[model samples]
Target: MRTRTARHAAVVAALLLTLGAPDVAAAPAPPPPDAAGTADAESAGAALVARRAALAAASRGGGASGLDFGACPAVEDLPSRVRCATLRVPLDYARPDGPQIFLTVSRAAATGARGAARQGALVQNPGGPGASGMHFPLVADLPGWERIAAAYDLVGYAPRGVGRSAPLSCRDPAARATGPVQEPVRPSPAYKMQRLAQARAYARGCARRAGAALPYYTTPNNARDLHVLRAALGEEKLTFLGASYGTYLGAVYATLYPRHVRRMVLDSAVDPDPRRVWYRNNLDQARGFEGRWRDFRAWVARHHSVYGLGTTPEAVQAGYERVRDAVARTPAGGTVGTGELRSAYLQAAYYDDVWPDRAAALAAFLRGDPSVLAAQAAPDPAAAAGAENATAVYTAVLCNDAPWPADWGTWDRDNTELARTAPFETWANAFLNLPCASWAVRAGRSPVAVGAQPERLPRTLVVAAERDGATPYAGAQELQRRLGAGASLVTETGAGSHGVVGGRNGCVDRHVERYLLTGGRPGGAGPPGAADYRALRAPRRWFVAPRLVAVHGEDVGSEESALGVS
Candidate 1:
């Protein structure tokens, strides 16, 4: 069913330069339960042994036997050397002798790595339990990614419930809610009730269609898959680079299997304060969006000559309201509505790269060219499909990961109050997550205790931007508080990009590369409390490669951020 809230948090899906599904392989049923845990564990252990051996052989350019090292499918934008294969893992680890699902894995085998040193397999996860990492390795094609690609076998995979793997779906075109935001929002009790019903219906629809597998779609399980991937790749310990929500996934993997993590880099760290796993994390996101929205408004105001919107933020906002009012009254080209326009604008808050195009698109409309507005506001169903799938997993993981406020009253009051200060993303975000109130799967499970015990975990490095509205800078600070005894925080000042490393800030990239390439301390990296080790700050300049700039008219300066691609 169509709904007022199609997908929220465009930032999650929008992160990596904007980045699907295969039908072929249905997972084979697990070995008979009569064979039980021990036998399955033994069998899995043996398979890992064989996989590790075959992977080692492949690494040395030896015969590729045992491992399914074949050419990757033609569909992906992968580096030439990248190979694709599949790994089977139990849907629920607790019951290993049960249903088994296949996870599509890709690898860019190391080339002439510097020092001829192969740092084992560098496993990656691009956030979203929905964000398919199948092509995350594609980021290797980016300018500065060459070194990491060469030093370690870059690995990407579709999380269990994403892509070719046992994908989840809750989409019902019939369930789509009608009408766009018709007027300036005046949130009333009746309006709240209407949205709440949409949220509930969406939740119910998910259960009706995909309820059976919802319980197992979680971060802990995701982390386990990484562990299995590590073993499959013949790595003694996992070398991981995760961004955004992937940071949370990595952290969980570390906590659950710390001894197995050789090296880990978490970019744009998520707030790990157990108290704010998701429910609170999202509210904080609204404020971040509000702040980014201001930056965008000011940018548009600055380009008043080009956009003809206004010369001040207030004037720019007035112009926005004009467009909003027009679309609310009459949908643009019979498709772009208040909701679509708002979602389109939401992209600006995610990345400044789109500000010019987005502003120009809206400006053309204000100038009586509704076609420009219509084209700008047109929905991408393909994107929407991926997002809804991601949303499906987002809800499943978030709802199953920890407890959310089950009472609508709490959500209503909190979001209503928050809207007073940050209206741009508040209610939209609330609706995005409101399904949790009626989630078919019960929550209340405590989130992983990330920094509670860092002894087993290696000294980790976290990169974050002061203005990253997606995860927020507070998360980095919080990570330090918890892992400070062993971790370092790289703070990118004055930047608002989501993830920090694929090819963003040189300073942050240097730190990450040095850490990954050289292993631990004596490699020029200091102790956890050392100057740069503890808190490394980036220069003010951004490096925007032409390919990274997708704005219309002029570019947002000659700078770009990383492909955090999570």
Candidate 2:
């Protein structure tokens, strides 16, 4: 679910809100009391201490059987009602006493007793294989989510190797600084050699830094950890809402523990095909992004009077290429080159609301003002560690969960072919994942056979955006079919965004709310055999003014940064 470039760095930082301490094995030493910490750090530390205390208090009730929940330390912007706890689980399921890791869990309790009685807990994951879920409970404050919050405890947790868990830090700071930018369309042989060398070095860094824990970071293990958390929470069955990569995690959980699942909602789903585990999925993403770019071009064309970039899609595209060429010749802000330009504007593919901003930025750059480009290119010092942790976890999980071709030739041939059709992101995506070819840890097990036994699972709801660049719409349709009679597919027919749930589509949100709250699904109201669901053709304005869908009066924006599309 990795995005094309550094723009997603902001998203990872925003969503990596930590509510508890990192597991002892991987926790970093605390900064000196005199040292200034970001507000995010201070709040995360305080909440973690409080959560540990609560977990200790709960132990008195029944050891690990009853979770003694208590108020989280007051963090700015976090809902006052949310409670936090830390649950320790076996680092390796095969050896329960070998070592221990902790998962930080948060819950926004149901509003009333009756609502609480209907559904016990609604566990959630916000899609990054690396993204933190500590802040997820805050969604309870949103409009449509109030009913859900009233009906079930909104639960969120940081997965094993993510923030405030046993976080992984593998990349050398120097390596990251010197990392190669997106490759040119037709790079020289020397450039290929240089990137491959960097890829190998990166793989070595992970092996040296992550060491033992790297082997256990696969999706199945994360699913196993979910089961343990479920038991600790005293829930007989799991009810979950997972977006982006979270959807893949949910599917694996249902497949592994079908009977343990009570209900599930998967938005922006990953294709479960083993062959497309990651490498191929990224290739598919290349194609999706190309289409999304075309959409962006069309939008720019529509606003030609304002942007003055072009009056047609082709002209707009040409304008973009001109910018790329100019940046390549002389880097803007001394850092923003063609790669930076691509990364900055790629946001338009994820959410339509950003189209205007992106267009404005592009127009400014074309008009001899590179400030916008420079501002976007500047890296955030505060997000450095979180970004490293996310990159580590993302690589660990994807590399270890399934096999990748060890030969560079396979990648070269495949990427070359993909570039012929989907040039925007093919090379970038290929290089981003190149390290997997030389990953230190071998593929631990076969990719989870997702949708392997969908009939054995309970009723589930699947939502997808028609032109979603990250998780393409086809994957959602395929997942729905695999889930068979028990699953319903809700399509945002023309929406290009990656995340659909709670993104202000009343039609989609209502269906999600109904399914989660009352166990009611969209009936067979569409044409016969039409996936047993409805399709909402998003309004044109839906693309232009995404803020209209802000939840709880605050824009949830796009989760694309946190959850890489495919």
Clashes of each: 14, 2
lDDT of 1 by residue, 113-143 (tens): 5665676778888786588887665555566
Error at 285, model 1, angstroms:
0.7
Prediction 2 TM-score vs. true: 0.82
lDDT for position 349 in model 2:
75
Worst 10 residues of 2 by lDDT: 548-557
Clashing residue pairs found in predicted model 2: 1-564, 470-565
Q: Please, what are the lDDT tens digits per residue for candidate 2 over residues 244-289? A: 8888888887776665677788888888777788888888888998
Per-model CA lDDT versus the true structure? 0.69, 0.70
